[model samples]
Target chain A: MSSLIVASIYQQVINDVIHNIQRDFEDSGVDVSVLNELQQLWETKIIQSRVTNFPPEDDKNQLEQEEDMENSSKRGTNKQKAKARSKSYNQNLSVGNINQDESEDELSDANSVVSNKYPENETKFTGQSAASLASIINTSNTNNMSANTGYPLSPSQRKNNAFEEDYDDQNSSTDDESQNQPLSTRAPQFLASGVNAPLASMSPMMGQRNLDQAQQNSSKINDLLNNNATGNDYMYQSLGSNSLANNNSQDTKKPYLPQNDGCDDPISVWKIFLAERKLKQLNSANKLDSTEQNKDFNMTISQVDGDNSENGGDITEHMVLCQYDKVSRTKNKWKCVLKDGIMLVNGRNYLFHKANGDFEW
Target chain B: MSQYYELYRTSTLGFALTDSLDELIQAGHITPQLAIRVLMQYDKSIAEALTNHVKARATIKGSLKTYRFCDDVWTFIISNPNFKFENEVVSADKVKIVACNARRPDEA
Candidate 1:
């Protein structure tokens, strides 16, 4: 059986971190609710990952009840607050469970409803001054969901709309309509307005040459966009070919190479950064493919070789985190005393207070 | 403030916490600065917890595939290792050992 100590170890770590950071939270002037949300999110993530088995819910509740009973007199208010938090958390989980079979859109909608109701739940728990806390709690809940679901695009788009409204009051009516349009259609207008704002602020004495340059830059941007569209489609095909072909294509697609000469110009600098980022992404993707192929080839070779020598193959995934009491080596042999270690083997995690290791290099 | 090694952040538990923190940051729930503070707290907490709370003992034997000592840290790659726990023996084809100095840098 796997070691049962991991659950308590993790629990103790969470408690320690929360306890230690309480003062820091207060010092930073962030609401306590965010801290509680952090703890809740951490626990939910750990439980979801299933890296190690935790006790069943009934047993866990029993343990918490026992602890509550023992400390009820000293920390009664804290216990009550914890109870409220857990109750709300359970409701959130139940909502998710009930909507699990629904479409993703419906599930997200249900989550939003629960998020809206969260402030009322907090109000009931806190009694006074909850009206002020309601908005923060609501945003926290929505943001928490966005984090959990791994789809932050919608929230960011909403933020961009809010930003646009704040900056462009005259265009607010058009902004409301644009918000309903697809991002591709909306983005160009946003960029155009952004460009026009600075130009309008500049004095005419800045010269027609500057205006002409701006027009030239806009044309160059259009060319870059067209290049990007074709480059992306080619990238999809390049994944099947070798890295050399990808590099050759990257070299040939240098229409904007002249801009790199103007290193002092901010626009050119930004363009260089963007180009480098795209190149890095492409190179990293190719590296991932090669590494994956190497891994597969190594696995096949290992299988064929069949345990011929102890040190014949690459290191597998097993790992140990510990402190050494002493490490002594003689010739090619090695010995060490490892203390307070967590060992991960196969898929299970084990904790050891002391470990004696004997090995030959 | 005592300094602790951030190496354990690569472990499974630390990786889980880091992933959670990343999600929170991406959602704009917490700032990257706050996440760094939380991770620092985690490093101290787990190190202390492991030292003071853990009580199990084990013995392992293997052939050391590679060993390196640098900047007061030990990295050992052991092949075909067998771990003898209290009740059972577990074996792995290979295991990497990351051992930080038992003494804190401040103390040293």
Candidate 2:
């Protein structure tokens, strides 16, 4: 029976380990399957433990006791807060239970880690802000639906969603594993700190050329109306095809990249990729200059990271929304990668990068 | 105790990585350091006597696809027909992560 108990013990450990690995690698590409065989061993142990009713360890209660002791100091008003957080967390976990294997209690404990009601005021992995982590972690099914979100979701909807997620991330339960290093944050927020670093100093007019081209070629409204009357359907179709083909070619250039190890470290790999991208941007800009085209507004470095504030460092009291040079200004769409290679998106700027806004419109 | 190594030793039993375990650990069901340590040791990057940890970006989901490179961080696509990845620094986030399939038949 001791062998059975040992089997159960190892299985439990492996199962839990794989579960965490999945969470780490879920949305990102850190293929954690390198450790998957261990999961079967764990599942077996769990089944054995259940059939035999073997109790391997009770250390969980000891930790809970310590947690209670820690929270005892603020027992007066935090009871409600704790209850609400734990309750919602439990609900989320129960929902997860429909798809997972953990016991209800175990899953609830885990959900609290990503729920809006934990004590994640102290972050682990990397000491990023609650607001950022809230968006990054526990967002498994976020894009399961198409981003073309049937009806436009208002900015308030986005903010409210972001706010709830931030709450969960900030107050997430502080597990031992989470207490390690902080998550990766791309490039130290190269622009947010207002460092004036060259890596973050590309001009924003970099993107305007394409917009200007689109607008310039957008045949006058009267001409378009006349063309609509005279032109054949084939012409419009061919134009549409040409536009899509151009965009596809730009997207498919397959810029050079260093082989990346895992899926979860977008920030790290992106920074490394961007380092090479800087040279390409310079080359492209030079070519444009030679042709005497797009010289007016054609440089922009808009990096983003955990350190970024609303806009570099110069926030205006009377708000002037810095408009982005969009590939297409159609609403509810976000295309950071444009026909002119990758470009900036409005919302957040990193380090001290600013958009040198020059519009031909 | 050394989960990855033990599996490596067998090298016979079919192995498929599960995403549920990653969720559990992120949610605090298990320890990340210890778990990753055990996983890495199985990757043969660790010595039995060495208990210390070495960090590297493991797997990532990017805008286009969800993929994980080998230990050297070499490129390997995890789609329908698993193939060696060409060199490039690809981001890991902003992609939809699907569950990994079974390991190659010749891995043993």
Candidate 3:
């Protein structure tokens, strides 16, 4: 009776942990597709470890019985659905050995739980992918079984041994009564079992690390989708589809263009203000054609450039230095001014894009 | 104060959100989980606002409550999408390497 209670509790805890992990991934912006991959990876690890760790035939038989009963009941509705399918479809769906219905059913149970949890946006595992994943899991499990039965442990299996040690430490410290019981009385040890005890305490750290990795992977995928966007260039790619679409149409309407004249030379604020004023005036006049306005705009920018060339260089330099000093003083920091009209950020000079207020370096 | 706190103070929106959080913390309603969620929400809002060209003050309604923040300077702040609230100031080359989805000059 005590053993049955312990087993039930363990199963409940596993379900809770799986649910929590799903929630954690969802909150971290991991979509259904990636979540599916993560779940598969975790389940694979659990199965592989179980194959190696559980040696006694009695324990294996009991576990298989429990898993079979649970999976069949869960898949009870699906069995009828499967009956209507053609033999070829059933063969395709049954990726594992036909005799090992219990394990296959257990695998499907895990997959179905994830799908059922997110009915609205779940990414279901297709037959082909599920088959391939099952095959991979089987091969890994066989390797683990061989390592346990015949040869010394592989490096990864050694890690699993370490995990078992940690699990023993945790289990012994927490449940002294359970420690006295025979190992065969316990439930089949899976990868998640060892990790679950530490999960509550370590979840924040683990979740954060996993979230960071997932975010990086997704960002890389996004970049690849965007024609291998190079260096601050992906920003423009994503922004172009939305807010910039309007700007693009406006650009087509107006023949006026902003040109990058020199890398070092900074456009005076006054020049931009003057240009804005002239453009506004020309827009209001409604008499000048686009080509004409474009000509006027270019002439105005060049004329401002020419006029500034006389004293604009020195004055702008002085103004930038003063602004830099003001910022530095406010922040209680000292920074060296550089040759280019760059803004000092964290005590370093970086070229500033006045139009969008970005670093141009 | 973290670098993000400093950066937030530079704008009205950042100030408003920070102030609101301060008020919540003082009120004893803010947990660590809540704080992290709020921070993530703030970052997402900034990114979304930048993409949508919301160049004015906007109100964001989170799961907890609604708060208003200035977005006028978001275009400048969002020049790098790789920025997170937890990130420190990186070098210019690293910044340049961050793919910017900012509107092109033609589009702008």
Candidate 4:
């Protein structure tokens, strides 16, 4: 019986660990199967402990106590705030119940780390901020849909339908002669509400470049357009769409954080890879005199002469990002191998020491 | 407890290292001090550790170390499939060290 309990506890731990790993490595190239290997190791440890007539110690009770303590404090404050908000919005107890169910799901998903509403506030993790944690924690599917979807959702969906009417109202308010008119059909209303604009229709690469450039040029306009587009009503009412709506509401939440880990913005890595290739070509061809080619690469190259006095002094500048290539010959290759690489996080550069083959900062 | 040595350090577990160490300690696999020592010696950077602990950055006495040798005194061992790392614990009071050997499996 003790072994069974132990197994269940270990399984829960493993499941929680895998979920966290999935959340952290969502869009990265990091092989998450390493966690599986670690899981197997734990299983072996459990088996070894069992065979030796010594079961793995159970800390489930203790963990539960710590979690309960953590939850009560957070729950108290959240209840007060939730009560005040519901009263001001003239919302009923159903909304409060739905929000409670969502936060509980978030707590379990984050391994009882206790995620609060205000993401920018200081998080409960050691000393990190809530935004830093929220960026990585997947909080979209935490709603207990089965319990609250049928009854409590009608009011919210009505609100959303009302919101759609507003979009229609605005569309009709526009110049009557304009070709961009709101379609009478409900499904087409979503597509016509400026949600699927010309920019979204462009190829992903062009769209991304245009979006980046647009953001750099006029961030306010970009944000306004995004807000206007996503605020429209949805035609479908599936769980997936509901979660997507939640994600849209949390605009500040990024799918990933800019940690020193090599899995940064894939676009940034691609840009660096292209820039490095161009730099290598220029270096090999003795074309350092011209700054024109550098402009073609679209990367800033700052060259500092090592020493003026030394005849054979080599020019030295730190590579903005270093990704290790197992095949040394391929180190100059354009593809990024970020598995073992130098990552700069929070201003401290965690470098892959070429000499020791270990990450050092 | 003294006879069994830790084959893996806390840092080797990657991003989940901290939580894994805590679990291992709670499970009685290893003491908390051992985990702390492993973390302390993993990279040994005051600034990086502090920044990792807190989201804020600070300047410390020793920054990250870098090697840009002009001479051939130190040869850069390129990452090869044969680069095998063996971590072993010899005796109690002695530390577990990682020894890397660059040899292919088919090599005589």
To one decimal place, how large is model 4's interface RMSD in Å?
20.1
Ranking by lDDT: 1, 4, 3, 2
Q: What is the DockQ of each candidate?
A: 0.37, 0.01, 0.04, 0.05
| Residue A123, model 3: Cα distance from true site in angstroms | 23
| TM-score of every prediction relative to native | 0.52, 0.20, 0.17, 0.19
Model 3 / residue A235 / CA error / Å: 17
Residue-level lDDT tens digits of model 3 in A172-231: 221243234323111211222332222223222321221232232233122111111110
Q: Candidate 4 at residue A243, lDDT?
A: 28
- Model 1 spans > 4 angstroms off: A53-315
Tens digits of per-residue lDDT for model 2, A1-361: 2222322233333444445456544333222322232342233223322222224223322322343365433321222333343344343321211122212222222233223322221121111112233234314311111110000101111111222233333344422222342331212111112222231223232222222222321432211111111111111222233322122112212221222234343222222222333333344334333422221112112112211211221111111111122222134222221110011112110110111211111
Clashes of each: 1, 69, 8, 0
What is the per-residue lDDT of model 4 for residues B1-108, given as tens digits with 9 covering 90 to 100? 222112122111221343333322211122233334433333233212222332211111111122221221111211111111122111111111121222212342
Please name the candidate that would achieve the greatest lDDT relative to the true structure. 1
Of 1 and 2, the candidate ranking higher by DockQ: 1
CAPRI classification of candidate 4: incorrect
User: What TM-scores does chain A show, candidate by candidate in order?
Assistant: 0.37, 0.18, 0.18, 0.18
- lDDT, candidate 1, A89-176, per-residue tens: 3433221111111111111122232233222222111111121232233332322211121111121122222222222221224235
Identify the superior model by DockQ, candidate 2 or candidate 4. 4
Under CAPRI classification, how is model 2 graded?
A: incorrect
- Cα error, candidate 3, residue A248 (Å): 29
